[model samples]
Target chain A: MAAADKVDPIHQFQIHPIIPLHIGGYDVSFTNSSLFMVATIVLASAFLYMSTASRALIPGRLQSVSEMAYEFVGNMLRDAAGKQGMQFFPLVFSLFMFVLVANLIGLFPYFFTVTSHIIVTFTLAILVIGTVVVYGFAKHGFGFLKLFVPHGVPGYLLPLVVAIEIISFVSRPVSLSVRLFANMLAGHITLKVFSGFVVSLSAFGAVGIAGSVLPLAMAVALSALELLVAFLQAYVFAVLTCMYLNDALHPSH
Target chain B: MFVTSAYAQEAAPAAAEGDTHAGTAVPAAEHEAFPPFDAKTFPSQILWLVITFGLFYLFLKRVVMPRLGGIIDVRNDRITQDLDHAARLKGEADAAVAAYEQELAEAKVNANKIGQQANDAAKAQAEGTRKKLEAELEKKLGEAEASIASIKAKAMKEVGTIAEDTTSAIVEALVGGKTDKSEIAAAVKSASR
Candidate 1:
């Protein structure tokens, strides 16, 4: 309650529906989160589209960025899952751009972070796990379960190893979603808290205002760190997606 | 209207705070649970994520990937073609150098052969001229020797006659006479022998 005198660090995460709507007994109202998503889609898609519109042999700066994004995701997928994993290229690319754009856009003041919500990240994580499951079974049938069975384990320890593998497997989506959400939430909160210190500190007197620079400096440093996190988390999400898809493609190993 | 209301909601809390610290002014929608964990927004966020992600996947797959990949493929193909062209030219250049060297070597051999023939011809001509001069000098020396022998024989015969005449003159002057010419010739012959 003492923090009430300061900015609510949680204020930025609030989601009030911009256009309240009811669809099939669901509160599917367009919230600020949705607006940011729309913005992300438009911006990412437009960047790719316009940047490569000319498709120049020697690309200009924007085109180079777009191309690097393509290669960066492409190489990450290829390295993790091998050439055959390229089938999930669209899925991986979409997830990377979506998360990346959303996080970057959220860094702007008062913009809702779509990825900071558990449901959003969970949905993405589930989608990746879901794709792995569906595609694994569809492609490899019962052999997909071989993912749990090790190649050269003693029969005595095999049961324990399999149990651990299964537990780890189940935790993948949880970890994936929580990692992104918690990082963004914690970073944003910490940043807000620092800025809050500056605000609350300045109110005391002339000396207080001058001393607020410490927290202000901390906030600036935190902003730089958050920028790194923004990109890194997106990359992490995509990388995990690729690894999961790898499981689908080669469930035996 | 939505923006205005949201702005109004944001302004209300700060206005009530009396202190002008707008930095900490809380949002209007204070939840019983944390805002992020609030279940009410789940459906909307999930719905939008699906719709947005689904649409995003489609757009990338259908549009972006192909175009970007097209340019890359084009560039790669162009590079490959250029390299192949360059390699071919290099091969051609190497072949040309090889041919030039071979021709130079052949020309040198031809020049050597021609020079050898010229040297042999000159040598043979000089040998012929030397042999002709030697043979001419040999013939001239033989003729001169034969003439000398003939002249010597004639002088010997004349010397016999002169001996007989001198013997006759001496005898006639000193010892009364030109007697015994045949004997004098015999004497002269005996003495010359």
Candidate 2:
């Protein structure tokens, strides 16, 4: 067997260059993963744009659905982030749509999973966390430091509590990126492995084909689970982003 | 220590494992080397970010936000209109209640006046009737008294005539013959004594 044929399933997750290009000192390769990420954003915008192009008094089904999704996230932001939460609506709403579209697009055969990459997920996470920090400082000035110093803690335990708060605050971006990337990575790999099994078993004529049925069934089940996860990851991302924003807005609680 | 060793043992073959049948053993360099960015790509991450942000911003400013604001404004207007209508209705109701009460008070006063008037009229009528009846009775009594006095005078005159006649008859009988003047004078004197 050739070395190329023995490719590891895990290493299959790679950002291959879509276009071969080089700059001064930078090897800026246009990758397949970048293409999909762009596509996801385009598709998401188009979905929202087409859905809400016509604002009917008695809205059509698509319009109603899009409106419901809008209100749902708006209400969630309002609930989590309060009346002032609307300021962050565009950011949170975009994150939800972007992540949701990327995950769903990756489910197709021969598609690049952009969200499965750490850099993409980290970029979004950093944006959210950075906004929270910047906004917190802008709003509260020096008082934003109170977020680290827990209120009503006993004097003796204040130092220990502050240390814990600092760590938790620092871990926000890590946790956020990991949650999205890990889920996408795990789900896609599982689907790929199961699908590989189905292909392998089908080579042995009718008996092998019959044996292939088990993995095929498993693949189907995992695909359905992956679809659920696509929506869940998007929801989780949006909600956590809301919570962090809430902390920034209301530093006391 | 046990968990670390166990995880290391399990991970050893897993890392070495590969798809030999596909004839594509991915090099270690592919895994380790950071895949740098290329600009000629038709759809890029930064481009998508710009597009998404632009589209979303436009929708929010132009389409979605305006419609939502309109809905909220309509709701607020509706609430204010309802409150105003209710206040107007209440005002009308209060006026009606006040008017009814005023009418009731006026009616009460009018009824009391009418009652008082009726009582006074009745009282005046009764008093007038009583006065007229008493005057008539007084006139009848006076007439009766005058009639009695007149009848008494007539009776007295008749009695005087009868008494004089009887005295003259007694003097005539006692004198026995033609001595009229002397006999009459004697009789008068005796009767006076």
Candidate with best DockQ: 1
Considering every candidate listed, which one attains the maximal lDDT? 1
In terms of TM-score, the best-performing candidate is 1
In model 2 chain A, the worst 10-residue window by lDDT is A1-10
Cα lDDT tens digits, model 1, A133-161, are 99999999999999999799999999999
> Model 2 off-target regions past 4 Å?
A1-67, A83-85, A101-114, A140-143, A151-163, A189-228, A250-253, B1-47, B54-58, B61-63, B83-102, B140-193
Candidate 1, B1-193: lDDT as tens digits: 2233444455565446433223233444432346688786788889988898889899999999999889889999999999999999999999999999999999999999999999999999999999999999999999999999999999988988998899888877888955888887888789879
lDDT by residue for model 2 (B99-121), tens:
99999999999999999999999
lDDT value, candidate 1, whole model? 0.87
Candidate 1 docking DockQ: 0.33
- State in Å the error of residue B150, model 1: 2.7
* Model 2: lDDT to the true structure: 0.73
Clashes of each: 2, 16
lDDT for A38 in candidate 1 is 94
